[model samples]
Target: MKGRLVALVGPEQVELHEYDLPEIPPGAALLKVRRANVCGSDLHIWHFLSVAFRDIVMGHEFVAEVAELGEGLTTDSAGQPLKVGDRVAAVYYHTCLKCAACGRGDFSMCSNAVASMGAPPTSPPHFTGAFATHYFLSPGQFFYKVPDEVSDAAVAGANCGLAQMMFSLDKVGVRRGTNVVIQGAGGLGLYAAAVANRSGANVIVVEREPVRIAAARLFGAHHIVDMSELTTVEERTQRILDLTKGIGADAIIEVTGRSEAFAEAIEYARVGASIASVGNLNVGEKFELKFAPAWITRKQLRIVGVLRYDPWYLRDAIQFLADNGDRFPFDALTDRVFTMDEVIEALELSESRIVSRAAIIPV
Candidate 1:
């Protein structure tokens, strides 16, 4: 079969290349792309803000239908029955399950995280990335059948943002009656708010961008703190504290990808509260900020760093969206849609933060 993929030739440069697929090998499958999302994390690679992989697909967080299934595969990563023609959201980490990290159920930390997608173009499975007409699901990569009731847009993020956010939010304990302070209103932040709200927490989101601030409310943010009006770290922190009745938030999550948001998160968290850092995917971007270590010691706060997530959370993410799909406007997030041919324009708009989220439908 012949398919097309968007290749990252260099920093901020991409080319649409066509290639022929090889015969399906055992323990592998091919997915005809349905819709792939331009996640905030993609912007890092799009603008060369992070480590850019050459001759690879540029998009992640997608939902697709099973075009062909290989032998020896009976169920998804979540232990549910799988078969061709099923729409599914797969895990991004393609790990070797026997690794020490996988032995302890830490698949995200596995030694071989890029077993498949990192392969060269001449390899049998040439389609490594989701920004293509097809995606090759190699052996051991976890995938879950998306709920039949869920829409494509709602489950698109189930692969990354929603899955990872569900994992982090669960670890941080944003339970009923807890106050959650979300820093940033991008997909990660918005997804965090949705999960926290679903779990009965009062969600307060802080974002300066007007477009995102408006989008936050749709994602179940009970309160929105506009950073533009606050104008200073002290003002923004005070607004958060005031909303929390002076004791500070029960949990504060940083998803702004800003280094200074870390110190602000510390100030907004109450004693013994938990804080989750899910943004900051771009490693090279740095800023100098000062905060007393004594504050952490004095507050006795629990600070956690989140990068990737457990594979099963992808299943949980799909089920969560399926169960509560109507509570929040899932469709609104992907209203600004583009086709694969418009890849460059899509990346530009996503980086500019013109829209909260955008979907690229593969032609």
Candidate 2:
């Protein structure tokens, strides 16, 4: 069978190419890709900031339908209970069950963990990524069942962006009446704001883009600050403090990854505030801690780094979206949809900030 896949051939080139499907192995299931969402990490791979195995298929966030099942994988009979024709989202990574981190439910930190795509396969094979027409699934990795009410786009977003945000929210203890400052008004930023709002927090969104600032308000931002009009970081920080009634924000979620934004987050953080850094750390960016000594001693602030989420969070995220779908208006976040043939153009548009969340319909 022929499958269409996005390939990162070099630093400046990403193309959709046709390739032969690999044979299904025992204990694995074949899935037809339905919808794949373009993510920030995919852009990093396009720019060579994150390395991709040469000529490898290049998607990690997607939902698929099971087309075939290999021997030893009986439908609802084997230890793995997925049936053919089931709509599911791939877990994309696996860790050694016996590892210390795995025991603590920290698969991403496991010494023996594997990414489903990109990395070369390891013994007993772990980390299978989903960015192609079809993917192979292994036992012990999670494959979630999508509800009939949820659309393909919702599933795709829940699998990555929403899931990551939910995990970060849990990490930072977002709760009723919590004050949150979200840096950047892009896809992830907007989603973070929506999630924070659903968690009953008053959200303040700081963005440089005017268009995104307007968009942020629609996405549940109680306060919007366009940094372009502000002359100094203190001015911006003051705006956040004013919105929070001089306490500053209880938590700041930095999604821009710019050094200046990181500094601004620290400046605006409340005493005992938590800062969750979820953005990419680009090259040549240095965050200088000029007020660290005073701020650290006075505030007792906590700074946390968020990688991808735990597999279990996917279910929680999906449920949150389902319950709060009406309030969130997640459909508005999706700015464009493209077929597999237009993957490169969709990616370029996303990188240029022309759209919010671009969905790739593989079918």
Candidate 3:
């Protein structure tokens, strides 16, 4: 069999390439691509912002169907029965379960995990990216069968953004009646709102963009603050504080890519609170503001940095969508869709933030 892959070859350069798909080897599998999502990180890669990923395959977040399972592979990571034709989503990376990090079930922090996407084509099973007709999972890459109750649009982002949000919220231990402040209303922010809301937290989303503000509300944000209308950072923070009755946010999830957001995040959080920063991923981008080092120590705040997520979160993410798919506007998240041939244009649209979400159907 043969497969097609989209490769990020240079700055803002993408090309479709072909590869041969040998018979599924032991413990390996083949996924018939369904839908791959364009995430904020893809925008950076699309614009040629980093050199390490210049020659890597383009996408990492998607959902697929089990086209074929190889020798010794009949069950998913959770030991559930699995077979061809099953709809599924998987962790973006493969963990060497024997590593110290994996030994503790912290796959996201595993030093030995191989990222399925972003790997060079020189590696066998070159269909490492999801933006292709088929995706080949090398040995150790795990996947979970998605429940039929989940819609494709709702499950499309489960592997990346949704799963990461699950892990981020868990790290903060958001509980019932917890006042949560979301720093952005983009994909991750919206996901955070839904997740926190499901966990019985009151969510307040601060966003300047009108589209995302609307999206935040749809995603279950209890309070929406339009920063444009607020006028300044202090005013926006004060508005959030007011919503919490001046107690400030018990927890703040930073999903805004703006470097300055974290500086402001410190101001929004209450004493002895937590701040989980999953956004602000730009490399070498300088923050225009400054903070007092003593403030962090005085507050005794818990600060954590999230990378990807545990594979378990993928299953949890899919399940969350299945349960709440109708309650929130999951369908509206996918504002645009493109064919495999429109890869470049799709990236451009996503980069421009013209839509809340964009997808590539590679079937």
Q: Pull out the clashing pairs in model 3.
A: none
- Give one digit per residue, the lDDT tens place, for model 1 in 188-270: 88889899988999899999888888888888899998988988888887888888888889898888888889888898888
Best by TM-score: 3
Residues 4-97, model 2: lDDT tens digits: 5666667857665565665777867777888788888777777777643444467778888888877876643122466778777766666557
Clash pairs of candidate 2?
114-127, 115-127, 116-127, 116-128, 116-129, 117-129
- Model 3 scores a TM of 0.96
Model 2 TM-score, 2 decimals:
0.88
Q: What is the clash count for each candidate, in the order shown?
A: 0, 6, 0
lDDT of each: 0.83, 0.74, 0.85
- Candidate 1 steric clashes: 0
Look at candidate 1 and tell me the lDDT of residue 198.
Answer: 87
Better of 2 and 3 by lDDT: 3
Per-model TM-score, in order, reads 0.95, 0.88, 0.96
User: How would you encode candidate 3's per-residue C-alpha lDDT over 1-363 as one tens digit per residue?
Assistant: 788889887788888888887478999899988999998888887777865466777887888999999999988877889989999897887788888999998889987655556578656778887888888877788788888888778788999999999999998878899999989988899999999999999899999888788888889899988888998878987898889998888999999888788998898889998999899777789877578978899888899999888878888888899899889987678889998889998998887777558999984
Q: Which model scores highest in lDDT? A: 3
